[model samples]
Target: MEIRTGELSNPHVIKLLQTHHNDMLKHSPVESVHALDVSKLTHPNITFYSLWIDNNLAGVGALKALNTTHGEIKSMRTSSNYLRQGIAAKLLTHIVEQATLRGYKKLSLETGTAEAFLPAQNLYTQFGFKECEPFGDYEPDPYSLFMSKML
Candidate 1:
């Protein structure tokens, strides 16, 4: 698979993001869905990437510079066709390596607390992320699960 920087103006990348948003809405409530939409993902602090396998979009993920020494994982989604193929794992590994290279001392993320998100939670756990209290603009919410890993 080829992972490359993505511009929000690209239609394929935009569509992948929209699909991810739709998937979140289907499996989580609006309030529990914290993923950045297309407009939000275009922010200067975020670097977006698209994973392509044989020219077909396979997945998408992003890293947001939360501060000088911290970063946040955002919008990790594997295409339905690519699910269970370790696509998410590869994307996550790429993001984490980039964060380390960028000098981030910590990497954090927020995901849904629902059972539908168990796979994601397990994936994060395998990468050494531990449950943590809310950070940044987030307040404690039962529907949200916050986690952080030291780089």
Candidate 2:
């Protein structure tokens, strides 16, 4: 497996992100889904990456610069067929390493609080992320669960 930058135009990458966006909205209320779309993830402040295994797209993740010392993890999603295959963990591990390399003192993310999101929350917790108050432009919402870890 290999992680590569760019390739945003690749068919598999686009489909994976579309599924991620759709799932977020499907599981969470419209107002509570904070997942970014392809355009949002394309910002200059954000870096997107896709994981490939034998040239097949396995997962995708992105990191967004919040400031010089802070960053946010966004759009982490593994293809349906790759579920439980450690794809998400690998993408997350890569994002955290990139955050550290960028000199970020902190890395944070927002996920849904619904039962469907428990696995994701647990994954973040396993990586040392703790519950936190909402940051950035986010406001207080019961459906939104925010977490952060020191890089």
Candidate 3:
């Protein structure tokens, strides 16, 4: 698989993101769903990436710069067809590497607390992320789980 930057316009990438957003709503309340749409991912502070295998989009992820010393993981999703293929892990590893290279001292993320999110929680835990208080503009929410790692 090859990971490329800035493929938001690709139909496959857009579809994956839309699916991710929709799935988030199913797992969490609409008010608690923080998934960004294609336009929001295009913001200057966010760096989006798409992973492709044999020219088919396999997954997508993004890192959003929260401040000079911090970053947030966003929009991480693997195509349904690519589940269990390690696509999410690969994208996550790439995002963390990029954050470290950017001189970010910490990386944080917010994910759902629903059962559907267990795999994601496990993946972040494997990377040394531990549950933490909400950062940035987030407030305490029963449906949201916040995690962070000191890079």
Candidate 4:
């Protein structure tokens, strides 16, 4: 898969993001469903990426600058057809590398506490992320699982 910086104009990537938001709404509480839409992802502080395999969109991920030293993972989603094929892993590695290169000292994310999100939680765990208190504008919700990895 090829991973590259993306803009909101990518229709396929935008659709996947919308699907991710819908999926989160189905399995997570309102507060725990933090997937951003295209407009939000296009903000200056957010860096978005898209993964393509065979010229088809495979996945997408984003990193949002929370502060000079910290960043947050946002809108990470693997296409259903591309799931379990290391697409998310590669995208994650790319995001982490970008965060480190940008001088971020910590990377944090919040995913749902439901089974639907267990795989994502596992992916983060493999990268040394551990449970942490909510950060940024988030509050501690039963459906929210906060994790952070020091870079």
Candidate 5:
């Protein structure tokens, strides 16, 4: 699959992001859901990407700058049909590479701690991310888990 920068105007990408956000809400309480919508993903500090295979969207992810030397992984979602195909891993690798090239010393993320979120938690762990305390504007919340990796 080829991964490339994306814009909010793409309807398919927009729908996938909506699905992602909705899924997060179902898996976590509203107060714990941190998934960004299309509009928020367009912020200047965020770089969004779509992974396409045979011109069909396979997954999506983004990197948001937390500060000059730190960044956050956001909106990482692989289409349901693409699950277990390593698409998320590939997309994550690309994001990590971009962060390293940008001179980010670390990358972090926040995700749900519910049973529905176990797969994502495993994926992040397999990718070398380790559990950590909340970062950014987030506060301590039992329903949320934070992870970070050195870039």
Candidate 6:
């Protein structure tokens, strides 16, 4: 698998992101769903990535620079066809390395608290992300679980 800087215009990447957003909506209320759509992922603060295996899109993820020393993980999703193949972990490791290269002192993310998100929570925990109070512009919400890792 190869992880590279992604283009939001790529149809494969767009479809995966749409699926991720739609899945999030199913698991949480609209107001509680923080997954960024295709257009939003193109923001100047965000750096997106796509993992490809044999020319097929395996997964995607992004890192958003919150400030000089902080970053946020966004749009992390493994394509259904590539689920359980360790694609998410590879993309995550790539993002974490990128954040460290950018000199970020901390990296945080917001995900759902629903059972559907348990695997994601476990992945983050394995990466040393611990539950934390809300950071960035986020507010406390029963449907949202926040986590962070210090670089």
Question: Which of the two, 3 or 4, has more TM-score?
Answer: 3
TM-score head-to-head 4 vs 6, winner: 6
> If both were scored by lDDT, which would come out higher, candidate 1 or candidate 3?
3
- TM-scores for every predicted model: 0.95, 0.97, 0.99, 0.97, 0.97, 0.98
Say what the RMSD of model 4 is: 0.9
- Pairs that clash in candidate 3: none
lDDT of 4 by residue, 18-52 (tens): 89999999998666688899998889999999988
Candidate 1 lDDT for residue 117: 92
- How much lDDT does candidate 3 score? 0.97
Q: Is candidate 2 or candidate 6 better by TM-score?
A: 6
Across 35-67, the per-residue lDDT of candidate 1 in tens digits comes to: 899889889999998888998888899999999
Q: By lDDT, who's the top model here?
A: 3
Residues 1-151, candidate 2, lDDT per residue (tens digit)?
A: 9999878888888888888889988878888888888888889999998999999899999999999999999999989989999999999999999999999999999999889999999999999999999999899898899999997
Give the C-alpha miss distance for residue 75 in model 3, angstroms.
0.2
Better of 5 and 6 by lDDT: 6
Cα displacement (Å) at residue 145, model 1: 0.5
Clashes of 4: 0
Can you write out model 5's per-residue Cα lDDT over 1-151, one digit (the tens) per residue? Answer: 7898975788889999999999988878898899999989999999999999998889999999999999999999998889999999999999999999999999999989999889899999998999999999999999899999997
Q: Cα lDDT of all candidates, in order?
A: 0.91, 0.92, 0.97, 0.92, 0.93, 0.94
Q: Show where candidate 4 strays beyond 4 Å.
A: none
How well does model 2 score by local distance difference test?
A: 0.92
lDDT, model 4, position 104 = 98
Error of 3 at 102 (Å): 0.3
Could you report the Cα RMSD, in angstroms, for every candidate shown? 1.1, 0.8, 0.5, 0.9, 0.8, 0.6
Best by TM-score: 3
